[model samples]
Target: MSLGEAFRTAVYKEPVMVWSLMIYGVGISYAAFVKPSMIEPHSKDLPSAPPSLKEVMAGIQAKLNNK
Candidate 1:
């Protein structure tokens, strides 16, 4: 069979494989073409660390007192 016929048969037999390959291709294309700046965060400021357990308990206690 010709290349096109073989490809069609493979697609019919393994649809999931074909779909995975298509998705991988799209992802690769996007990464290759898109600028790094577009993908990365624009802000230079880093996120603050999570609140400590003590801080969390204090907030919970404050809420209980308010209620």
Candidate 2:
């Protein structure tokens, strides 16, 4: 069988595999290209350090108190 026909048959028989491969390809493409471009403009906006446990707990406590 021609390669095209073989590929079509394989895809038809294993649709889930084909779909998963397509999703994986898209994810890799996004990570390699789209994600970097998206993140670059916002890099400065990101916090340099994570919040401390005390800060997080205080925020949570404030929220609870407000409710």
Candidate 3:
């Protein structure tokens, strides 16, 4: 049988299956259509950029000196 038929059969056999399916569908729909800005704070600070080459070199030098 197809996936739809199997899902219908499961739902019919167990009423609780409907609740789980409804939650799953709602979660998927929200994630699919909702904007990220709407879900989270737009004013939140962005992440810092990665270390520069000079910073990385200094870190390596410090490690070598410590060793």
RMSD of each: 6.0, 6.1, 6.8
Off by over 4 Å in 2: 1-6, 45-67
Ranking by lDDT: 2, 1, 3
Q: Candidate 3 — worst ten consecutive residues by lDDT sum?
A: 39-48
lDDT of 2 by residue, 8-41 (tens): 9879998988999999999999999998999898
Clashing pairs in 1: none
Query: Model 3 shows how many backbone clashes?
Result: 0
- Encode model 1's per-residue lDDT on 17-42: one tens digit a residue: 89999999999888887756665675
Q: Is candidate 1 or candidate 3 better by lDDT?
A: 1
Give the per-residue Cα lDDT of candidate 2 at 58: 100
lDDT score for candidate 1 against the true structure: 0.86
Error of 3 at 24 (Å): 0.2
Per-residue C-alpha lDDT of model 3 across residues 1-67, encoded as one tens digit per residue? 9999997888898778888888999998888778664756654555467789999999999999998
